[model samples]
Target: MSSSIENEYFCDGLTEEIINALAKIKELSVISRASSFYFKNKKTTTKEIIEKLGVATFIGGSVRLSKKKMRITVHMIDTVNDFLFWSETFDRDLEDIFKVQDEISLFIAEKLREYIGHIEIEDKLVEPLNLSINTYREYLKGRYYLMKFDYESTLKSIKIFEEIINEKPNFPNPYLDINQGYAYLGTMGLLPADEAFQIAQPYLKRALELDLSSPRSQLNLSWIECWQNWDLQKAYEHANNALEIQSTDEVYLTISSYLTVEGKLGPAQNYINKALELDPFSAINHHYKGYIYYLQQDYKKAIQFLQKSLTFNSVLPFPPIYIGQSLLLSGKFNEALEYFDGLKGVSLKDLTKLGGKTMSYAFLGDVSKCHIGIRELETYLNTELMGKALTFLVLTNVLLGNYEEAIDYVELAYKNKLPIILLFNTEPILKPIKNHKRFKKIMIQAISDNSNYTPIKRYRHSLLHTEDISKYVKEMEQVMMENKLYLNPNLSLKDLASYIELPTNYVSQLLNQGVNKNFSEYVNTFRLNEFKERVIFDENKNVTIMSIAYDSGFNSKTVFNTFFKKKEGITPNTYLKIKRRN
Candidate 1:
């Protein structure tokens, strides 16, 4: 009898100890048992496993015990072609069971090395496990629970993994698995990026050092570098290295999605294609491919691809929002509205709010309602709503003849680091702003911030004295400082313009051109900055962020927190803790 590597190792009735043992082998890339066992009982074909696990080779075997003796058999299969590379069986008395494990591991490692024409130093260093095989059983149970992906189960798994690791610190797999959990938290945006990276990186680094060719360690490190560090170039290089070492797996596809986020549409598309060839049913690759098309503004093609993506995920809200927008832009207005209606309660606001409403209004030719939606979008932009709202604001403002407002939105969008505007070189909404030197400068800055490209021009203040336009609006920084206008609760662009004896039109233009922000944003950024500074410096004041918001001239604490979190990437309390730590 043998263990199946799934919930049950042996069929019929057999009682042999089953230990999930990985090799102490050095160079061959191995997927960690915890991650690999997820597919143990899966009905997926071998080709599917090759793509999903990204492992080129898979091994299966069974063990049986009778009369105080252990008999074992193992088979090695090539995943890409479903070819059997080797098969073997061994028999040993109970006293020699430990020797049996060591011999089998060494035999497999040496045989593979000779077959592949290279040998690597064994990297596995075993730490003693204090518990019975029952402890290992609990660990496997924890893995099963964690794979269910519920909060409670994950926490249970963490506790189990911690217990195991505390008992065996040198056991590399548990450290790697726990680190994967932290990385998952970071990816889900549940934890702060810095904190998550701090918890995950060291463990992953150690895992790699312990097993330099372990595909799991490489996968985790590459993903952390891409997602947490935002080092796309390094991520690309690491992912390429991992793929070269072992091709046909989920790790490569996961890394390719990062490239898509960076707007490397062509490369991302090609990499995902390779990923799908290895694992044809991977929903993630299809989902990301749809996003690349969406970025390219191919609404029809994007819709088609995204629809196929939905077949892979029928319930994800994000893809539907993209589909709705494509439908609206493609003139299927009623159908678009239906999709929006479908998202009423289920949608995340930042995903659907401004874009859905604005598209609906614009498609219906309800200019007044469209402008109302635009105002709401502006309000959201000034406060904290990001993503599609920012994208819609940048596009809609320009389309609505609000050129100065478009530039202002562009500046704020750039500051927020929205990718849509950063990719504006190919965007059409930017056409109205393209010829204006001010808009060009804003685009350049956005591109630089997004792409880190060289040759980006800085945002310039309005030229008060130009040859064709000899008129000049006096600079407003001193005026703003004198009145403390930015911090004033009742302050508005109109009030500031009136105070300076300048027309509101001229003031708006000057703010966008000179200050590179809309009136609301220009004021809010200063307010938020001041709020942050005071929160740090005024420890004796015993002030809450709410109180600070009012004192700093913000009318709403909600607005204050929204803007604060966006700018700082953490809650006020967390920021305070970080400040205290420093």
Candidate 2:
């Protein structure tokens, strides 16, 4: 059953109560709150919801509350044939809200049982809650703030939950919610892990003491065990207990992340798929799906899912960050640079944003800018944000061809037990040094105690490899020379390969092996040579410098200047002035 309520402090909580009540029917497979609430205010057809959620029937409704009265209107729809099976509107006094909820839940359950075949209604399914309306209102407000999913909002929710706990010391819901808020803050790098987990421990324990059957309490305990104590068995036990109670999308995604770090890709993929199925429109689920594909080195699918995530929530910086990383790895350096440049004015100032800029500049051969970002990241080394900052620094160094320093940072991250190091074995950004003895040794140590330890394998072959390197090299040079392909500002490796009737991988290999340069460097070498001949040798005496650059395949003047300075140790104008003086 999916429902929304208006003009009430505890609208979401009331909706969740109805869904949970219906889920108690042992015969019915209920759509979880995460899946149902995903369509709260969105305009969607019943068929679309059914197909996405895999439900045969759905309940939709809203509640309106006045000062002293409440009205709830609900409708049941059979998605198979788009028929309204049953519906009703009920008016009741504010004091009878709990009774109204019970009536609605039982009425729907009985009607559904009659329609689909009779099933016995158990006594345990309708346990009475002994909560006051004021306490419930506060609990709902806490839930509302928690759903915002930001560090500040989470902190606010924790404050609200703490107030509730003070007023009603026996309330288990607020205790569980406070633990979840702390977990979110710690996991997202917004708070120190030690500080967050230390504060959360008592709340978690209290919640379980009050309500031993609460799945959320178990889930929160699992996170603390896995991340803080590193107790895999206990963590698994708690996670399993939570899943047995309810297999919600958040729980599935959490388990997927745990499996990913353990190098259990197959099982992780299953959980991630389940998460997407349960919450298809969730940007976070899509982001994690792309991230899992990325860890598996499936760059094509990684970029596809990451792009889809951006379409859902462009305000999020992580999707674009992953997309840029995927393009850089696929040898589309120019495209990746363009994407990074487009994020110039975004408000996000986190390590992801800085890392994207650093890696893009490093790959594009802008060493000064890359180092600037590195220095900025170094400022966070002594601060509480060291884990996140250092992880990105490692990525930046890898792109800058500073493998030794990258390994040094990896060692530090490992020593600190940062969770980001869990991806060391499968992260493509660290692939250049995957075969390094030190890197392999560190990876072995990182997961040595875990049962699922696997050796990190080096990628022996390029994604685009050909046996006849010299043949492709000659063909590539001829195509560039005869067609003057470098004159096209928008030329890409795919375009060049299509023009020469060669495979993209073959062209990439020729550039990497025969020329000792990537696609971007190979193309820019020609452009720089053209610029030198035209400007330094006075081949274009009457043309402006910008026009000469534009004619020589450089799209942006700033990029042309930066590339020229990086290659020649001087800007284009300075180089020209020196040549003329000579």
Candidate 3:
């Protein structure tokens, strides 16, 4: 009843007489002959068709004519119970096709009406949710794309969902609606962490409010919180809640793998196995199973499962990355390099680069290049532009003997108030710096909000020459002053590179050779020193926190507070008050 029977199926190839007669059926919920026939000869089962059509009973038939006579055969099956309740065969002339279909349809409807009236089937058939038929179709398409798990195809699904919502804004299908945004955020990693969460939260919240009966929204939110914010407690509750409501979802357990990596193996294993049963073809599911073994430090088993994942979707990045990571931990650096070599030029994004570059440098024993890789990762972290990528950098930095740099990133985790230890423990790249005293101390302080780097390749292209270096830096500083921009905010080597019209890597090289400071600490040192001087010497106290923050070129109040606390060990307000008292 939600969709006009005419809109229910594709009857494109059927004769007009047949289409019109089928359309006239008063009782048969005959999906329009055009729409129902769309699946002709396609290998879909009765259950799948019933689910797709949103109908409890489906009536199908075939017609044949021989020796100038026509015969019709029709069967009506109870899809939910998989039983053929009624069937009939009619013999007639080919010209009587329309009459046969109409008569059969009328007869079936009258019989159903009588059966429902007598047995009260109408009382039990809960009316379908208030969803536009078009939106529901789009949602099914979105689910189809999600099942495929390829990046490009998944993105296409998101675009369809966007179009669906645009077409019908008030449609109550919130779970299907907001899932597109979550996919966008997860895929693009465009917004900063807090900003990303803000974008995704409304859809998830609305989904919960609209349908306590649907678990997909809650399940997605739980994973995002776990992976993006490291909020395990909330993740556990949401994930468990979803499984309680719908026990068949595979992703419900995949989120638990993060907890497993933090040494909660039993729950992790339980969820991973359940997810596999629900969707056995998912390469990602297999990768997680392998990841669980790696978490238990069981390298051999990890290798086996990860390899199996490759057979299903050879292009999937994590299984290869994890295999490489386990290889590194097992001291098979050379073998790890072989793995990373295969991953180059694949669309593994920033985080994969961290793992691939780390293993490559470590296996080759190129300590200086390893540090260079770590510096590049530092540039990524201070920007906080990408979470999965930043996670990669945090571990890689520790691996390359740059625990001091790890301090800078952990400062970010603390500012977000995320549990840094949990992440640090599971991330194989940080295996090198796990025990450093300064790193541990900073992790405990819960101070410091690190700024992120913005990628600007246009700026990087201009500074390939030595002469351009001074000009580039001077122009950048001038732009900061011209705009009164905060020097301490999420400025990356690329931003400076973009400012001067040079390449990012070139600017990094110039800074290393000319300025002798890596991208982040170099910028932070300038900001911190300026902050200290302004508090002590700017006596008129006309510099309100917001004014000074802008003058210093900081972007947000949160970033300013975090930077101030980490650099000076006091809140900005308290620091200002103490300075004034003195």
Candidate 4:
């Protein structure tokens, strides 16, 4: 695709370098490379690419290499206005390719931060690589085949990547790719999850050995622990470690998945919202966002985002299942049946398909077909030994009105530490039976077993004595009521700690333990109370709501209203009007 002697070696590589650099900035929503480079070599207009990819802008340019010297031209195009934000040309010798690549990537990031809203580009976008062009090309070639996504292509990519590992045993990236290759194989059902993750672990272990601090490496181990070992505790630990290091979309999604299965719907939705912000165009993130809504009983929004996810990738595992369930939950039984039967992307072997068909039949009151689907699901699980599919059986049982059977599965799942047991508390279908004595007992036991991570995962491990926490709570309440520390609009845990003359850790622990709220929640509770008191008073009627809100330490109107509704079950304006009238 190039006329020069060293054609495109730097161009394609440089593009990938730019993508890598930008992806590290969690503030910017950079689509994954597979989605970003989807426009490569295609005669697609900038408008079409941005619309399809749901991006604001993109980087594009060309490279022409004639012997040791290369001429590179690059520009940022704002797809909305269809004009150049910035452009630059570099004429440089190819001897120091790593330096050139890093410099160019950094410059592009600088330009992006300048053009776009405030982006904190503190870290270098691209890392230094000391290697031959051949090694880098081989790595790119493996990536090329890996992205092809076919079985043979993945095998070829894995083989090439392993060869690189043998050649450069110290390099971490190839090992990581191999880990991903096996992960993809497992996710696509080409291999058993156990076998695939087992094969992937050694490579991931090497990656960890090379860079023990890598969040990505920790995330991969988290996946292995969750899916293969069924160890949610260990998985949560590794994932929490990764989250402490990086806030990437992948880390957010994985943590969200764990929280969702654990029936922590509120925190689950919060994490998925973060993921969607960082990778808005990702079908999986959208699917998760929909699933969160479905669990929270918001069928309309559930169906909306699930359908949106399907528009991007029709075959995502969860959306089709949940969209159908959402429709059925809305009493569109016939429509649910039609939708379930019409999905071409769902294979009969998929857990999603199995669960969807069973639930759809049951929702439609087709007892015969429901029983038939149940038999099929049981047979599939018994014959294949799919631990992951066990949750679907529990779901199907619940919808079929087999309360005793459902309870039995919950006990079995709890015995095996199947995370699906955690779902019984929040699962919409299980709402009717949630009060069953045996079910409640099992759920209580399960919850007691799993450590609560919200509020303070770290400080809870090394807690102050109960009396010490209670003493601090008294001190905090006294300080809040008298000094009104919550009046500071920009108050923080550290700031509140200073007012009480306590260590920040002890204050956080006391807030979580004795007060049963985090610092923000505790302060916001006081702020909301203050706002309510002001609004209800007879004399303060003429002031604007936002002005009063600011006086009460609720700086952002959005935050004030959101907290008001979350606590009072009505918008601030509605509450204000009703209170004045009363």
Candidate 5:
């Protein structure tokens, strides 16, 4: 990167934009922003990065933002053969950043056909962020903090995004990102799920009205409908929509959870399996898998997977609660009590801390302690956090042998449209009332049939041969040799592509695959060759090297020297010294 120190934010934002755009293409297995950015500023080989990330290819780049102009030099490398797949340098006005991102994503998709099979690239991914450069910089700052993925950083992101909302109220991304920040807080139990979603819903609605296709928007909206609104059917529908646009572990997990709540365990297992396949080490996926088993009354497998999930992420709030319940359901009362006793400060939620203890004490015949938890829950019912305690209250009553009271709570849960009832209703603790006439009536009333759902069909284009790019490659070479276009200091990929009367993607594909260099490397090779030709002449000897560099189509002094050193393993001055002596 070359610019004021502040442009680092701009550079990060540009990269994230490209990642975001490419991730929208359903067929491409684009790496996450955090995962790919891990190699930034690290001294790592291309093969190591590709293998470590488990990707077939990867893109790397340099960016320069000066005043209103932006330059991005990017390259894609094929991991299998260790060869350059495609690369280009984009030069555009700062406001045209969205256009540049879309162009790169589409071109990459076109080039990746041989590696990943046919991919569908949309016409656009990110909406045009129509803001002053300064405002855009602020938005980037917000995104930078948001990607940190911690409580304090997420809250910081929320505040910054709030400021953007105040200044540029119509920009969809800031609105969407504000929702994302709040969503992280809600899920981590730092904030009440109801409160967090309520705070973000207005902003989220505006963002969706502006652009509903963003992957984050769809996922966030689905969660809101599930957790906040209790509209499980609509939640499943939104999740399906998001998966169709971009199949991610998050979307797959969300669909799995929704399917689980509908008592569709087979489909739920399939979705969760897909989620785990994508992100095998994710603790959340493990937790959901365990929860699915717990619902199936398989207490032993439930405890095993839940314990595995806690090993990955120890502070996760609900796994401990469920593990205790699983232990009790397995008839290990002492183990259940011990597990509940060991949960010192795993969560801030009062219900999570109390539910397991209350149930453990009930089975142990400690009536006083059990009622103490029951009283604490009753008090919670009178507070603003009322929705938090109902699920646990139902389970506690069942464990206390108050099957009738548990049934009453079930009716209340159904009246309030709680989505998790169908799921936990399958718990072994509920076995006594699960088949009761009244319980059966409520079960019928609680679950909505989302089984008829079908996702948006992902269409693939007809395949093309790998050797087909050879024709365009030769045409690009002929155009370059005839026009001496490298002499133009301000040339870009678009300009060269236009001169050859080929689409920009076609020319870039050719240069990257056939010529084996990016646009910057390809053009700079010509200029470097031109520089060498001129510098050796007696007429140019008296002329300064810098002046000859300009005459040879080298634009910036930094770029010229850097490219020369990288290619020749020495500076231009040293190269001139060696050549002139010979």
Candidate 6:
């Protein structure tokens, strides 16, 4: 079910009610409101909707509200065949809104069950809710505001939930909604963590007292336990209790995140997969899945999922941020820079874009530009974004080869318990100093403090072993030479691994240990040789340096010139002049 066009609050409420009604049928696997609502006010294709949600069929409609009347138009789509299986239009007075929603839900459920050959159902699947229309409207408004997820909107939601609680103090749903609103405010960095949690506890306790069976309340409590109290066992217990009542996408995602922080990648993957199965259309779900893959050092798969997440919602900063990081980790430095550059000027307020640009510039060897970004990010340091800003500064320093300063910031992040530091073991930006004694000590301390902490094992084997380094290096070089892989400006570690029939981690290990160089350094060595022989000393001097750089697999003229000067102690043009004069 989807939201209505005219009265988004009412439409969203109706859609959620229908979904909840359908979920009561034990045999049906209903998509959650979080996933289904992702399509609200957006134009999406049927095929895309089906593929993203993993739904066999879907119901879409629009709602129209007049002074005293309501109209709803609905169509059921058979996703497998792209067929409109049923269509209906309803006209009713505003007072009959609940009746209309209930009728519509039951009709759809009956038709769907019949279509699926479950014709002998004994009892009604949907139960009627006992609530006043006015109170229900207030709850809908609260939900509508909560879904916005911004600071002002969350505050507005809280206000509305407070109003509902005042009018009907025993209503558990509004209390739960208030708890969730504060939880989101804190989790999303919209408010001070202490304040948000303080404000949330009373609401949550009231909700649990009102309705102990409510899974959402338990899930909200679980988040508070994990993030605020750092009580992993209590968090797990609450999460499991929520799942016992109802296995919701949000609950699964919550548990998955806890597991992810613990470094239990296998269990994390399983739970996140369950979340995806329940809410496949959710951009957040896909983003996290990509992040998980990134931690696993599966760059190609991570890129694929992150890119898909963008297709679902292009405005999200996470997908682009991680996509650029993944590209950088794969040694596509020029490509990574380009990706970050494309995000510039889209929104000045997006810190993730700034962070990405800062890291990309640093990795591309533009120390000056990187510093400019670092200074810009520093302005956010005292605000609600202190943790994120500090973390980006740490990454920037790492890129600048300032390992000591980076470690200092890492220590600060650890002290602050910044959520970003949770990725200490897997963040590709920290790869340069990952093996350093200081960084390892920080990681060990972090792991020791959290019972859920699981050491990231993606690069464990390659880092621990160094046997047959020469053989691996030889294999890598042979594959590169045979394929002339160095000639491809967009070549990446993953691509090289594919050609060599080796894992990316293995290839990275060979370059770092066996050859005492990184992927970009090794590839640029061949490219520089190619450029000098084929272009600089070529009899035809008419060819341009930039053209030659491109032909020799150097994607950016700036990068080529900088690298060439660094290696040869002269600019490319100067080297050419000196060679010709000699």
Q: Write the per-residue lDDT of candidate 1 for residues 56-149, one digit (tens) a residue.
A: 6676676676646677787677564455656788887645544455566655554444223233323222333344444555566656555543
lDDT score, candidate 4, position 382: 44
- The segments of candidate 3 whose C-alpha lies over 4 angstroms from its true place after superposition are 1-133, 147-151, 172-184, 187-191, 224-231, 251-255, 382-385, 416-422, 428-582
Writing each residue's lDDT as its tens digit, candidate 5 over 485-573 gives 98998677769879978665466556655766767778888999999899999988889989999999986676678778878999989
lDDT, residue 336, model 2: 85
Per-residue lDDT over 371-477 for candidate 2, one digit per residue giving the tens place of the 0 to 100 score: 99899989988776676688779998988889999999999877776666666667878889999999988877665455442212212354444557767777888
Scanning candidate 5 in windows of ten residues, the lowest lDDT window is 113-122
Q: Per-residue lDDT for 145 in model 6?
A: 74
**Prediction RMSDs, each to the true structure:** 32.4, 27.0, 32.3, 15.4, 8.9, 24.2
TM-score per candidate, in order?
0.49, 0.70, 0.52, 0.64, 0.67, 0.64
Return the number of clashes found in candidate 4: 0
Return the top candidate by TM-score. Answer: 2
Which portions of model 6 show Cα errors greater than 4 Å?
1-6, 24-26, 34-135, 150-156, 159-169, 341-350, 432-582
Tens digits of per-residue lDDT, candidate 6, 1-582, equal 324433666777887888876765545667988788777657988688778778887888877777678888888876764656567799888777777777888777655643342222224434444667667777888887776545666789989889888888888888888888877765544555556778888988998898777677778778877776666777887887776555567877888888887778888898889788878877778888998999888999999999987777665556777898899889888898788878843443347778888888888888888889999988986776676677788888987889999999888777766545566666766889999998998777664444643322111234426567877778788888888999998776668878877655466656767877766678889999999888755565888888888998987665687679779988888788888898
Evaluate candidate 3 by giving its C-alpha RMSD to the native, one decimal.
32.3
lDDT scores of the candidates, listed in order: 0.59, 0.74, 0.57, 0.73, 0.74, 0.75
The local lDDT score (0 to 100) that residue 378 gets in candidate 1 is 61
Model 3 residue 356 CA deviation (Å) reads 1.2
Candidate 1: list runs displaced more than 4 Å.
Answer: 1-231, 248-251, 254-264, 297-301, 313-318, 344-582
Per-residue error (Å), model 6, residue 564: 77
